[model samples]
Target chain A: MATAEERSRLRDVPIPAIGGVRWLLGLVVPALLVVVWHLLVTTGVFAAHQLPEPLRVVGTLYAMGVAGDLWGHVAITLQRVFFGVLLGVAVGTGLGTLTGLSGLASDLLDPLLQSLKNIPSLAWVPLFLLWFGIGEGAKVLLIAVGAFFPVYLNLSTGIGEVSEDLLEVAEVYDLGRVEALRTVVFPAALPSLLVGIRGGVGLAWMFVVAAELIAASQGIGFLLSDGRVLARPDVIVGSILLFAFLGNLSDLAVKGVQRRVVDW
Target chain B: MADAPSEPTLSVRGLTKRYGDTVALADVDLAVRGGEFVAVVGPSGCGKSTLLRVLSGLEDRFEGRAAVDGDDVREGGSDAVGMVFQEPRLLPWTDVRGNVAVGLPADVDAADPDARARIDELIRIVGLGGFAERRPAELSGGMKQRVSLARGLAYDPSVLLLDEPFSALDRLTKHEQQDHLSDACAERGTTVVLVTHDVEEAAYLADRVVVLGDQPGRVETVVDVDADRPRERTDEDLLAVRARIVEALGV
Candidate 1:
């Protein structure tokens, strides 16, 4: 049989730059909102008491920054988020990996975890305040509770989603159970674990705000709550902006870690 | 034919595999001497892959005796065997070098000078020297399979098993892999057992080609190529052998 010996390129055309354009389009709505907000406040369409001018909010932020209270609130909130996320991820990941590896273990704990997940983190505020007495423990525990489910569930799903062939690869290499868990399974589940961490980070922020509102503390949430009691709408608006800024910062941090660690 | 002498490198006797009521392979006996390259070709559902899976000890539910160098194939034990499946099956997270290096015994000095040296040499031998840091996602199908071959040969096994390793590639890439594999096997005198649906590939690569018939697979015929190493496709004798194997498939 006659055969052609030349190597063939099986139509691997490069993807178009259309995807980048679509990404740029994602910025439109947020930009429009900021523009409209500034226009409405500047035009006096909304009372200053109801909606502070953007410049006034910025000025308030500047004053807070000069007094160093902005930094303090941000630092304390971040500290709570950091420790809470760490503790939650550690326990959740361990439980999740165990559940994923054994059906019986998953069956045993999935229901309890699922039930706890259903109760919003706010529901635990009063109980947490009663137990830990509105201190750092209550706040941190509340954030930990919020972060736990996402990390646990995502880690479990990630471990469960691991390819059977990949497991076979480890087996063919004669990797022991522990070695396989560490090298093969852990790496395989990392993308989902990062997704889980992202979810957990977002939830931790939500709980931090709720905890600050219910108790005596210093944080961006505390700043927002203090604005309400003092009837200073400018501080409330400033604190909300601060929360948005820090939330975005935490998300960026998570993304950075994902890139550095997962390399995906 | 009085015992055709010398110890067999691999032997299968009264091997039987069944998937519930459907019998895959039954009462089969096969043998290969050291350094012999045997190719098995069969129809779609003829249990060709099952046989390789059995040999690799991936599927052990089958009733059979498969011995490699006089040792029964056992699960989770390091034997002198390696396998390349149809897919490259590279770990998406690991780079080319790490993927190939995983084949070496885990206890081997991964951080040592000797292991690193051997890994570099194998990468070069597979013509993938510059692509070591590339992830599997960044590689072509052909390059990925080359990494797969490098992974299989990294361990220096007594016998290498391939299950349609290049069947997924384009025709030209398939031919290149066949040529590369043939040369590598000849250079090392490695015992090879390959299973494929393509009769032409079997004829070109095997010292002995075994044809298997339809379901509940059994050997129909065994043809000895007896052609010189590095045989060209244009050679009349090689073409004749290829024709005979294709005709035996009754296609």
Candidate 2:
């Protein structure tokens, strides 16, 4: 297991470098919001039941952490998103490449995919529930469905837009079909594919919450619903903030990978 | 080095190519003997590039025959043919050495020690010695084209087809590349067919210059340069040949 300092370095948080005025600029808005939140609570601008004090939410988070409930919910939510996004990327990339390379595949599949893309993630929840039941299957598939379209659209378009000059070079070299696709087509399309994966991962996080809200019993989304039943405003708002943090972290990870891989 | 042949290394007879309703080349005939340097010169729409494409086996839709070393080009004799396009066309993801290695024949063993040495030698020949690990984006345009030239020569092809490879460079860079190309090709004794619009370049580099006319592109004239190797740019013989090529091009 990594020590605390090593974990922080691995996360690349740059805490010691955050003392500058430039770094403090990012904290201004949150500070102002906190002051306003405190004023509202102390002045009784709204009922205490409707909007709890910010410190109360922090205390509630501490209580949940001490009880070991927070980590379990966070872990379960991350696991679902990971598996869903992986499966979605695999299927999307496969279909996208097939359609991009063959006119017949494009003609047969593009219309159906475009129509399916019009439906919102919430709209698919009912159908998925009916097809796969309210078990983990329906939730995972819902997240996958949400993640699929952006990857499909971006990858297909990227493959189609590879330079004709490079393709002609491949012909002159007499590279076989498989070799041409591997060397010429794939690398040329990589930047756009990275863009697709970033968007897909974002959608995966969004759909996970909706999936859990419908039928999940043990996830961050379930915590929100459970807090609602118990009339705990702090738990609901804390869950939303946690989701925001996790989503931003995932995006940063993807950007880091993109920078390292697509150096050209 | 292989023995030089007495017969023509590249032979094109009654070649014709048409795209849709436009005739790119019509009944053109040319031949380049073994180890000879030939340049095809013409005005903007005269199908010089198309002819090179046909000879290099990139275009197989032509009506007549083009052969390299007695084998029909259209039957996929890519191992015998190497091409340098107007642009470098280097894969951006690959470095200089990697780009040169891409030209090796499919059967060549990349893991073999000799193949790796050959790739390094080609890079050195192109004056990209210490920069083998640098990507194309880090190199200047002339440097990138040098990498392209090295790639064309990497596999020790029997024939090299260059489609205005130096036209994109400035004057000094073009002159330097021309000298580099002449020296490299002379050392290898590889048959070369270069397509250019510059008469002076054709006169200075090629053993014979074939001029093509536009509309239905066909051979107008073939001027032979009998000057010695490393001929001066202003030598009387090359000047006379350049003037004749300019007149034939009608420019």
Candidate 3:
């Protein structure tokens, strides 16, 4: 039994330690590079016109926030990511499980899906724009396309790696299909599923940027493009900074959930 | 000489398992009484684990009937039988308590006060009361196996099937575990079927050591361990049983 003090300590576990510090270390390098870039511009090592100073980027961000444009862009981008990832996770997991359970389905679909996954998500942008008409539909479809493969692959791998002994345990226990899945298969597969979600979260971010650059009218990607078209270096830099922050933040959030689910 | 009673709590007759063209256990027969500890020992790839799996009802793709308490083992019966694998195989995500409780009925509410109490007692019985909250990774191999043993016992099983459960442990730890296992089984009156390659371990623990031969396994001999319960490692009779097993295996 945990003492009252130990119980309190359990609650006090830092979300990052539970997730791991190495992933945070991965973010530090790019963040430091940005800081170094700002320092170079501030010290006149690079021309202000060519590379906007860090203060100018902050000023632009404040202006956008005050005018509520920042929230609008963030909201739109988030909505697209949410719908895409949700649809991808649902369909990918369902298909992945089916494939894992049935050898015939796995044999037919595995190679096809793997080959499609090899084609980068960005490569689909042009075709998606043509087929779905450069609208919300096209953007959501592209995000789903980006997120689907990693989640599906991970789910399938996880299901496949489940111990045969555990299956025997389930069989001996006389667990029905749903009960076996819930107690044995689900628990065994969760670590891998969470890993897939982490990979998918990053992919979703990548697609968000891709979607805005190629198809959407409003989003952080659009803001970045709009800044570039208007020759406003500060706005472009600010929007990029916002994407970096939110992308890192979202990755951290998924990682946090992964740690909780696979808490070892 | 007076004949012994032949009622078998577990009986296997002419059991045969083939994988494609390769036969595993062919025409093997054995009988085990309730509350008896039987250890099956053999050379490598002699299908000792295969025999245990079949008897546990995991390998139904075989010939002949394996009966438990006079009922034929026609299918995989996880609740009726409890198994400890070569590895602990605990769910890494579950804590010790949750892992042990996995063998219980899924809907049985493991959080119930009575179940929790039983789990707590079992943890102590298996010498893991202090490590209930630890995950599998946080545990040492012996500790993990202890948890596996606890989980198997938590099922309230009639027969405990162990597949080299202590094989992964160091020699010292293996002896410690053997002593504990013997004591625990005696107290609970749980029928145990242990599979091992170690002749000494089989001699030290089993009520009867069934020596098996390779190439489509068959029982060579059954060495009776008449050593008194709460047995000592240094006992002359136990060492003699070990000698008999080694001679039976021609090692």
Candidate 4:
């Protein structure tokens, strides 16, 4: 046999370019929305106190940034979401692995978790506040509760749905149950785990807002509520825009990691 | 190590498999000596793969004995065989080197600086030497199957079971992989049992071709290809043997 070999080397697949056109294209709608908002305010379609001019909102945020006050609020909120997502992911992974690998454990735990999944993030507020006394503990734990479900659900389903063919290969290779789970099952379930983490981060942002409502004094959420209390529409709109930007940034970071880690 | 000199490396006798009322295989029997290459070929639904499944310990519910080196392997504790399935089944999270290392013995340090050389050698044996860093998604279908083959060989198994492993490859790629497999098995002196549907593939690669009949698949005939190594595919004697295998298929 002529062992003359042909290696049909695959050139690297260019990752779908998240390039200038796509970036600029995404800006079109939000830019248009700001233009419409300027028109709505300048035309006096809505009263100034009710809906601030778009520039006024931008000016308020700029002023806050120059004063070095915006950083404190953004920093605290980011911290809360970070820790909450970490806690949520750690606990969710533990539980998801258990239920995913064992039918008896799934039967024992899945129903109760599924039922509690419906209890809105706000619904946990009363219980958490009463238990932890409206401190950072309560605030962070509330955000964790919100982040937990997506990780739990996605990871459980991902692990459970690991391909049987791969498992069969593990068996034929004589990978014992534990070794198979570690080598094959966990790696196979990683894409879904990452997807879950992305959702969990987004949820962390939402629940941080609810969490800061429990008497926070220095977060973007607190800024929004304070703006509402003092009736500063510009500050309120500025805070909302800040939330959108930070939440999207965090989501993009997780997605970037997903792309790299699950390249196959 | 304690085996009698007369014992076969892999043997299956009276092996029958069923799913409730549907019989997948019935009364199949075969034995392969060490370092031998055997291919089981038949029409679809002829349980060609079922025999492999039983031997690889994936179909443990079957009746009769599937043994490796004179010990029953059906009880699920056997570490004597490595199997390549129809699909690559590579872990998408890993590279070719890592996927092959997944089949290494549990004690072998796949992460060790020393063990990487052996893993790299396995990759080369499968014709994927330069592609070690490539991910499964970056590979062509034939390359992916080669990675799967490398993974099966990484176990350093006494017997290798392959279930239509090249069925998904193009004809030319399949031919190349068969030669790669033949060379690798020869180099390692490993026994091999392949299940395939292509008569030409069986004739070209296997020392013996076991033809199976359909519906409650049972062995029809086992044709010996008494040809030498590196035999020409178009050689008159090889063609005559190929004709015998096709005729045995009753087609």
Candidate 5:
């Protein structure tokens, strides 16, 4: 207790030793994969038509950016995802909270949602195209439908799993229904809600790709389709890479929000 | 100090609770006057917690007449009672101040200067003045329980129900909490009903100790402590009362 060095160590918060090195370590695998890809292309392991060189894909990405096409497509796709996720979160959270809190609501709604969520997202594309006519509505609805189930399922499960002890505390405090929902139920279910949002965001990205594949004028999904028709592997590969990057970025954003909101 | 006679702050008569075929409590009666400190001590299965729950109006299915200051316990709202559970049961997401402030009425403005001052006072009373910004996860078990006690007192309840509030703590911390609770309640003149298994705790803190027996839990005996406050733990009279409680517990 009297040691100066030990006291200083205790007073100073120890920085994680691996923090800086871990970022470098993480790049190693991707770097190795890119190297292998370049080698395969240089050695002509696959035909040029089948697989474009990595440099060609980079050239295509640069050209798209110069033409302002990349930003336009990215913006449209992001808009669709944003609105779809917002709508899905609102509806799913509302319904999930209702069903979670009320036995009668659960009895009436759970079986239908359970059955509906099983249908693949692609299965709805035909109906959505027919209903909304390949417009913004069809694409947004598809993503929303894809995003709704996970948020609903996880939120309901999380709410149902709130500790009985805490619920008793709410009772003792005589918290009104809304007050309890805001203060007790919401915080208790936040971690699960964040998990649900993460799942929903992933599905939203996937659904956007599917939605664009069916019919779209401007989007990364349209790039994939246009590349297939024109036999340009570069565009296809570049679009796929952009999707991966954006998806990672969106998921990272969700994680950042989760860290800030659900500290416990 | 003559005043108009008033009803007991907490009263339960012929309280009976059953879960299907199992009776948790049967034909139990208890009364606690305003500012009185009563401790309920008994064996593990003696339904001490159930009684507290009934008195706190959390358990409504019990067949009994339980009231706080002439109002039916169930009808009296948050102002009637505050309860501290065995576990701290603080919202882990909230800091100490937020947790304690949750005990206040919803209509109260959290940002009001007076409200903030009262919250600070309660936190100081519980000896958590410096830790108001700490989350429950950041605190030790004893500290968390202190926050829980502060939250209970924040309501300024006429009757405070404690269900083994210090049972999870170590011996030293438990005694410390006991003293803190006694002082806090004495300062506020709030009636308290504490449920615990420790005979010594019951003897040291309670003005009256009610012993209960198991099987369909019922009151076994009630012992009154005539000793003064701040009495030493080793005081002969307190020890004798503790011994009688231990004997009543059939230990």
Candidate 6:
């Protein structure tokens, strides 16, 4: 063992460099891609009408922004995705936990859920439109469908994977059934639950486009159809870029929460 | 009932455990007095840990009577027992304080200040005073085992069951932890039933070492140490006790 004096000598050692600004490295590829895109348009490889320049797309988005038309569409789409994810995750976690913890629930509910998950997101569009009509209900429910499966599947698998050793520890401590689940099983399954939430959020974005493409006056997905109808290639490309940016932003947020929850 | 003269803190009579065709333990019998430290030592497949699992109520299908604090092991008697498995088996998402709190008896409100004080005291006894905020992944193997020990002691059970808790440690850390455990249990006067494969560890820590034989484990011999506290590892008498335990295994 080190003496007090010797231990004190080690106290002044410098800390390692922090990972500040390392995230900027991720922007490099996108920046290069944008420059190449600009060159492809400028060098006349593609006609201006065939493919709009990067600046023109940005200019179109800026005009929509200045006219205050962009905010309403962005707000409505954000709201739909938000509520859809909320409803989906809530229902998914409930079913996932039930099926994960009980054999009876898994047996009764799993087959139907597994079958339902195989249906494509767009396939649900017409059925949902007919059922709930062309209102926000059908659109939000469609996105919710996309969000539900990943959380359900991931959480169910995560809870099932809890180690028997820890379960034995819980038994030894006399944690009882519910107490053991709260202390041992839930925390152990949290990482997988978070993983499912990230996937669910990604799917929600994909489904929102499908939801809006059929019937809606607002949302970024409608902008794609609207731009195509008007024969303005710039609007269509800008809408796609908006989807990518928002999808990545939400994913990053979920990842940040995952880091904090699974820090151990 | 035939031989037990007084009510023992822990008692096992005709304890037989089986998994299909294989018998892990058969007709094993043992009794321990209050505050006594008993260690069951045997070769790897001798079913010593099976005995511990039964005592701790992890295995409920045993064929005989095993009681802790006078209650049958299968019927809530295990509430009086605290167990430490070979692996730390801690929840990775929690810090030391929260993990230790998991062992608190059902009646104790974990949010209570008194409960927190007791948890902190157990942590201190296990020599982890300043590490209450540290997570399990931050600790070394020895430190993690120390946390496990603290957790086992948290509920203040009348009987503590250990399944080779220190068998994973290095030689030096194992010795230090054994000494720490010895001191803590001595102070609390907690009755202990430890199962380990290490004969020397049994000799060092147990008041009486129970050697179990291999096929369908049964008591081979019981060697009494009767040594003084804070015993010297190299003492002549300690070496004599170690020899007796090793010989009882017939290896």
Q: Which prediction has the highest lDDT against the true structure?
A: 6
lDDT of each: 0.83, 0.87, 0.84, 0.87, 0.88, 0.89
| Per-residue lDDT of candidate 2, residues A1-264 (tens digit) | 469889878679664566465767887999999889988998999677888888988899889999999999999999999989998888889988988888899999989998998898889888888999999888888888877888898888889989988988887776668878988899998888888889999999989999998888889999888889899989998888889889999999999998999999
Candidate 6 chain A minimal-lDDT segment of 10 residues? A10-19
Candidate 1 per-residue lDDT, tens place, A1-264, comes to 122322233223323545557777778997888789889988889888888877888899999899987899889998999889998888888998889888999999988998989998889999998899978887888898888889999999899989888787676666669878877889998888888999999999999999988785698899999999888889998988888888889999999999998874
Clashing residue pairs found in predicted model 4: none
Model 3 misplaced regions, further than 4 Å: A1-55, A104-112, A115-138, A172-176, B1-7, B18-24, B63-65, B69-79, B105-109, B166-189, B197-201, B214-216, B227-239
How good is the docking of model 4, by CAPRI class? medium
Q: Clashes in model 1: which pairs?
A: none
Quote the chain B TM-score of every prediction: 0.90, 0.92, 0.91, 0.93, 0.92, 0.92
Q: Global lDDT for candidate 1?
A: 0.83
- Give the DockQ (2 decimals) of all models: 0.34, 0.54, 0.35, 0.54, 0.54, 0.67
Q: Estimate each model's TM-score.
A: 0.87, 0.89, 0.80, 0.90, 0.91, 0.91
Model 4 off-target regions past 4 Å?
A1-19, B1-6, B112-114, B168-176, B228-236
Candidate 5 residues A186-245, lDDT tens each? 889989888999999999999999999878998999989999999999999999999999
User: What's the CA error at residue B97 for candidate 3, in Å?
Assistant: 1.2
User: Model 3 misses residue B168 by how many Å?
Assistant: 5.5
Residue ranges of candidate 1 with Cα displaced over 4 Å: A1-32, A38-45, B1-7, B20-22, B75-78, B168-180, B186-189, B228-240
Tens digit per residue, CA lDDT, model 2, B1-251: 24545457888889999988999999999888878999999888889888878877778687988888778888855448889987899999989988888777777766678889999988887778998999999999888988998888876677999988887678887887789889888888898999997888999999999989886899999999999877889999998998899888887
The superposed Cα distance between candidate 4 and the true structure at residue A116, in angstroms, equals 0.9
Predictions in order: chain A TM-score: 0.87, 0.88, 0.85, 0.91, 0.92, 0.91
TM-score of chain A of 5: 0.92
Error of 3 at B113 (Å): 2.7
lDDT of 4 by residue, B66-110 (tens): 899878886542578888888888988778998999889878888
Deviation from truth (RMSD, Å), model 1: 7.2
